[model samples]
Target: MSQSETPSLYASRVPVFPRRVDGFFRRMKWWIMIVTLGIYYLTPWIRWDRGPDLPNQAVLLDLANRRFYFFWIEIWPHEFYFVAGLLVMAGLGLFLFTSALGRVWCGYTCPQTVWTDLFILTERWIDGDRNARVRLWKAPWSLKKARLRLTKYVVWALIGLATGGAWVFYFADAPTLLVDLVTGQAHPVAYTTMAILTFTTVFMGGIAREQVCIYACPWPRIQAAMMDEDTITIGYRDWRGEPRGKHRKAEGSDNLGDCIDCNACVNVCPMGIDIRDGQQLECITCGLCIDACDDVMAKIGKPRGLIDYFALQDEAAERAGAPPTQIWRHIFRPRTIVYTSLWSLVGVALVVALFVRPELELTVAAVRNPTYVTLSDGTVRNAYEVRLRNKHGDERPFRITLTGDPALRVTLEGTPYEAVSVPAQEMVLQRVYVTAPPGSDPAEGARTEFRFWVTDMTNGERAHQDTHFVGRGED
Candidate 1:
């Protein structure tokens, strides 16, 4: 290949060794990490008193029973559409928030960031701070270095194990499972799940780290299109940081900009990209770089925020010696407003449907195999396979009534209405026989509608189904 045909540059993955810093942003990140991780690991263990027969865990996905319990909401298989509606609402919500603020979820709320930060903390505790860890990594194979690395791995393993153990409690009674787990009597499936989660957490959080965010997660690509110049993002103020230089004993230099050329931002970036170069796809916007630079600026007696969260368009405007423009697009712009309204409408409709759902449901398809039969008593007879359902926990008789005309009569073949009851989550196959007198027919085959109505004696709830009553041709 000719020289011109060669690619401009080779792309490679670089490792980030982010340093810890203290500032308002760092404090906020700590608070967010603690609160979010606390909720995630502890929520399944929180108990709610939902009668003796129901599970006490506040949130559970009882796959064995085909039920989902979330606080006060209990979802059955019949309510699956509600879950779909909620998912749609969540998607629209993500879009609306992304349009308002660029990648806030990626920076702060992402699980990868949360767990990685935690793993890094454990690393710091065992090995010391950023500089010490770098020195240790650079040193030869010494016993001290080996001991520090060993301690860090042990801590990482423990955190991963705890993370995995917390996840399985949502599937069963948390307290009982914990006892069973400690006694080594827990189900094989439970231990297998814990093992898998442990491996993933350690590998992704301790080892892979930001690679998961930059290369593995697809959100960054999708968000690239969602962002515009008007979206507020963590950006370096080029106007403030450019023309950077080192400081000397001299009072000031004309060419010297606000940046002191300390490389603090680069040293502390989790993704190892220089913010001064440009905003790259690998930036997670974790804001640790902001904390690092701000602390450096404070030590040098310079004002903070040489880099910051600002609209890039605004930075450009200020760079051109123009008045600062309000660069943030209003959240109520047409597209965002429409999306918000649609999301709210979907949520409202789902809530209404959940609250107003019938306690009992009846579905019927009249048997088609022998549509009708002639009775020995000279009346037309129709045999139907009917299934009875009772959603209530306590069983009771169902008063079945057939309503059509005065001459129409119905029977349960060999049973009475008082004997027909379906237990909770149970379906009873019933053979029903319907009869019509000769006077109840037209000259030819007549189309008459009959309703099978059932009233629950336990709750007074009623359910009904209407179908055709076929009559034979007679003159």
Candidate 2:
């Protein structure tokens, strides 16, 4: 293909040896690493008071119980839409952020990038910096290189194992599971999960690295569509840096461009791209290049920011005689506003729903096969399958009150009030019979509303359901 048809910065299939950097971006990356990794390692150990019968873990996905507990909210299987809604909101929020800032998530919050950087840091610390690592890789295998590589791999393996072990703790009681795991008594599923997570962690963090961001991930493709010229991204000031020339020992050349032809920016880039060329699909907009270039500029006695996070629109305006305009509008555009409003509404609705959720529910189904039976005593009796759900964590005694009319009398064939005790988190089916007063008919072939009021005796929690009372006619 022609150069015009091709992209500016072509993707690389080779591995990169990103040199260690010490600057603002590096420190930001360090803090992100610490906070994120700390959360991952420590959250499983945090305890929550979830009554006596339930697990005390602060966050747990109780798959066996079909329940999800996070701090205080207890989600039932039917409430999966809460999770779905949150995911939708998260996706929209990501879109909004990407529209405003290019690939910032990949730089800061992406788990793959974070973990890979952590692993790389560990490798660099244990073995050596980029140059030393490259030398070790090039040299024939020796005892020193062997020992260093062996130690690094062993540590990497342990880190991967720890990552896997922490994940399954969210499914079970962490302390108990830890003991069980050590004693080799954990369930088969726990072992299975740990193994799978370990494989993924080692493969992704230790091996795949930037390939995940470039080839495996779909985010860059999505972001390409979402981003605009006003989006602030890491860019090289080509106007200032063009006509790059070699730096002299005394820095005496007036014609030399400000860049000084130093590859410091390229060395610090985790994705291994030269920013001086232009904006690129491979750039994560990490600002590390800016930091690197700034340090280089300081050494060369030039003002910093030869490379920077810039908006294309502002650059273009500055390139022309026109005054530069404010460059960011993606964060608060119509799409973002709509996404925020809907996301907030869903969050508020879920919270309210959780608060007002009932402890029990009632369901009534009229016997449709033979709808009603007329006894010889001139009383019309209706049969219904009443199902009561005790959604609480303890056995509940529910009083079923029937409401229709004053003349309407209720007589259960064997039980009174249709009252039945249901076990905790269980449902019970009962055959209920309703009969009107003697010689009194609601109406021929008509259905009257029958209401069932379920009140939990223990907590005074109440639930109600209304259904039709089938009679010979309208009742």
Best by TM-score: 1
Worst 10 residues of 2 by lDDT: 436-445
Q: Write the per-residue lDDT of candidate 1 for residues 1-475, one digit (tens) a residue.
A: 6576767686775556678777777788899999999999999988987654678899998888888889888788777998899899988887887776778787888899889989988888888777887888778999999898888888888888889899998889889999999999999999999999999999999999988987799999998777766667788877777678786345666667778788888887777788888788888777878898888888877788788877766777878888655544545567677779999999999989988977666666677677777777778877777777655555557766777765677788667653487766555777777778765652125667779887777778888899877777621
**Candidate 2 on 279-336: residue-level lDDT in tens?**
7778888778888888888887888867877678878876676665554353566765
lDDT of 1: 0.79
Over all chains combined, what TM-score does candidate 1 have?
Answer: 0.89
Against the reference, the lDDT scores of all candidates come to: 0.79, 0.79
After superposition, the stretches of candidate 2 with alpha carbons farther than 4 Å from their true spots are 1-12, 248-252, 321-330, 366-395, 405-418, 422-431, 436-439, 442-444, 458-461, 472-475
* lDDT, residue 117, model 1: 86
Please, what is the TM-score per model?
Answer: 0.89, 0.88
